[model samples]
Target: MSTRGNPWAVYRRLLSYARPHLGVYLLGVLGMMLYAATEAGLAGLVKFFARGTFLKHDPTVLWLIPVAVVGLFLLRGLGDFTSNYFPGWVGRRVIKQLRQEVFSHYLRLPTSFLDGQQSGHLLSKLTYNTEMVSAAATNASVSLIRDSLSVIVLLVYLFYLNWRLAFFCIAAAPPIGWLMQVANRSFRRYSTRIQNSMGDITRVAKEAIDAHRLIKIFNAEEHQSERFERVNEANRASNMKLVFASALSNPVVQLITSFALAGVLYVSERQVFAHRLPIDVFFGFFAAAMMVPPHLRRLVNISGPLQQGIAAGESVFEILDQAPENRGGGLPIERARGEIEFRNVCFDYAGGKGPVLQDLSFRVQAGETVAIVGRSGSGKTTLASLLPRFYDVSGGAVLLDGHDVREYRLEDLRAQVSLVSQEVVLFNDTIRNNIAFNAAGKTDAEILEAARAANVIEFVAQQPLGLASPLADRGQNLSGGQRQRISIARALLKDSPVLILDEATAALDNESERRVQQELALLMRGRTTLVIAHRLSTVENADRIIVLDRGRIVETGTHQQLLAADGLYAALHGMQFNA
Candidate 1:
């Protein structure tokens, strides 16, 4: 939904987050009322000062006026303090609540949804957009409520003093409102552009930072800098449009106010000379009239933040509105028998792309090893991704232990499979913690065993802290093989019935590959293992091999059988050794 079409709709939703702090919010409103009343009180005090001190010149009135002035100021100070402090308290609470909800929603968003989004844009929404929402929901609201009340109270005072002059002051109201409406439209439009521009800026900056090594190697520093400047300049330009709208609005509104004020002063002067208006009464009326314009101006100026916030709220709510990843069916299982089947599977990505895998069917028996070999676009990884339910097939079923994989609860189903791919992921934690990542209840002995089996103990022993030693970001301190072994250790600790090794040692050197291969063989024991490898020699011992070409399985047999048949598998095998 477009927030611009129904701004109050977005604004009201934003305000709901502040409901938990309603008591504090009410206190702030009350303070605003007190502050507003004091403005009228100040005008009243002017009349009292003029009448008693100038006209009567009484000694008692002189003494009381000074005390009244001090008392009035003290109340104003208290009111200002209450209004400022209490709303700030509520705003912070709203921010905390909103941030948490957005963060939680991010975790549940479908993988497909995440695939289509940039990390920088998501991060911007978490930090920057949430702040804008708080400002719109609470900070802008404070100004709108406080300034409106101040204008109302001061106008009522003017009417009480003299009905004619008060009516004249409101003559500017209609045109001012129209002008503000126009400015508000401009603000919201540009605000949305500014938000998108900020996301672009974040996207560029993050890309440059993460790929600094790539940038340096390619001598592309100038290219990245230019990309950043483009986004940065766009953000500034969008902001300037908002600034131009805000800047033009106040002065034009003030000019309209000035004309009305001129009219009031012209009429009041004539009435005073005619003896219809008293000097003290005129002072009070004029004082109240003068106060209305500033408050009115602020009421118009508040549209900037108010509309900007609405735009921000729309961005945040869009994420919250997305459907989460599908929850699997009610079947429960502690473990699977490791039998798997893909019955007539057909799958494709979004945007009407042709199928990545089509009419593909396969099976692996319990404790048997199968390998899938293919060219770059032959759907090898895609086949493995489907087994984990990363993407549901367009037309087929993936069965485990004679039931559709979807019949088991997602957590229960995922618990039965482990994967170690070429792109090994490690956190900035100790070696022991990395191995025991998802094995929360495992004892220390189990963790140690997994680490030792995966060859992690060899290099870890060089560190002073051994298994407890902290790694750098993404385990950058470790060699390629070290990172791969940690991943293998994690998979080992899991010890699930099904294992997928997606080129697990593809990035390692000859020595690293040999050492890792030994551990992988140990990992493969008594499990339904599916290996996707580019290197044909790695899968030579598999019970069976499936060769894919253009989303179809063109050949399937044991290594020797495929070699005897001399088809796609034999050709691919020849090409690899030839290289």
Candidate 2:
């Protein structure tokens, strides 16, 4: 999270990704070695030609010059091909692997972790942030190795030809290093801002599109556009700042390099004219000087990706390093009966606030249908969420079949309790796929049966492709009631022993509510059901009605019994629907 630059730290982290592609990486290094040798050979040849330094100087040697030069280029070309192509292939493979793993991790993450995060922000991390690894793997890592080696090989030859001049050229490296430090500091700061702004832009764009109908109805198009533009402009400004910083550093280094080369040339010419050095040595110095600029330029240019790649590396590692949620240990409960118990249960929504459920104790016998009636913010939903261990109760225990829910593996605990909340969620896939979600072995017939049970089969059959008809993103093509029913169908397919129907009929119209309420009643039969209903009529026929007031169970009895008591339940029933 620190905003300081550390390119070497990034490179080391990247080396972990390279383990899978080590063979191709080794090939790239081999290619760079061959290319560097070829470059060194060309420098040696130039020195040989300049002063007839070849031991056996004749017509044959003169004719051989072009042949040797052509062969060097041919080998260098082959090396270049391997170096470029292999790393690109490796980079793509890494992307595919990392994306799959990140997605899988997201699936396993606890629901509490997802509550406050935006879907669009997570999508950007998975898609855009991870894709930066490609540039890091190919252009950044490969270029670093190839160019750094080339510079070293060429410098060795320059030293062999003329040590004094080579030493002078080497002296300029410290100033270049200082400039890179300044550039890297700026790049790191801007790079972090760019990444954060990308998330903001993605969040705003997703909101604008997701609520397009609302925006239009309210005529807020200009407002949404302005919000999006502000975030977009911020992202653009951050990226451009990094660009200008890099541009400033590279050119300044090049200018200094140009002046240094001129000084080296003047000194070498005087030494050669006075016979203090051989003419071939002087030409060799010039050849080596030419190699320094391009090689040094590449070395300097590495900063751009080096900074960005390191930033990406830190982000990726942060996720990969996270410890998974803890699920306590016990023997796996093979058969989960519908019995549930809350013992001295107390929970706070944000960990330290006053308990939403204080000294809450409750028990639901197997095959019982319990309707919980409460006003909004009375902690009805929070109490129900504890059964699935969404947020672990800060005080006591939520037990299933005499065992703590946390004692069971998260998968097993959730598999036993299916919930259909008022806020319905559906993926952008075929209706059949949405119904069969995470139910890997389910068949089309079974999926259809569940849909029919939820009273959604007839509507799906009307679609052009039947069950195969694609639902638009987030099931936006479907009506609110339709989306809610589809969710019920999904939960029905899950076939959990305990069903939690949380205000499933709250937002439906009279017609849809009538049809859906009938289906829900049938779905709850013979199953241990905990229903949270805002409409008093929906739960009037329940076997038991528990009225909660300010996190305490104010009354518990049959609906008629609660009405007779004329307590909180009766008060709520009268307030909502005078009876």
Residue pairs whose backbone atoms clash in candidate 1: none
> Measured by TM-score, how close is model 2 to the native structure?
0.94
Worst 10 residues of 2 by lDDT: 1-10
Tens-digit lDDT string for candidate 2 (1-579)? 332345576666667667877998889889888888877888887877775644336566577778888888999998898888888888888877877877877776666777756887777777777777677778877788888888889889988888887887887788887887787777767766877788888899988998999999999999999999999999999999988887777789898787778778777878877888877777766886788778777767777776676676666656655555666565476658989888998888763458788888889998899989899988889889998878889898998899888889777787888898888889989998998999998887889899898878788878889888999888988887888888888888888889999998888888888888887877787778999987888898888888887788888999889889998888887887853
For all predictions, the C-alpha RMSD in Å is: 1.6, 2.6
lDDT of 1: 0.89
Model 1 RMSD to the real structure?
1.6
TM-score against truth, every candidate: 0.97, 0.94
The residue ranges of model 2 lying beyond 4 angstroms of the native Cα positions read 1-10, 52-63, 351-353
Clashing pairs in 2: none
The digit string of per-residue lDDT tens for model 1 on 34-73 reads 9999999999988887777777777887678889889988
At residue 167, candidate 1 shows an lDDT of: 84
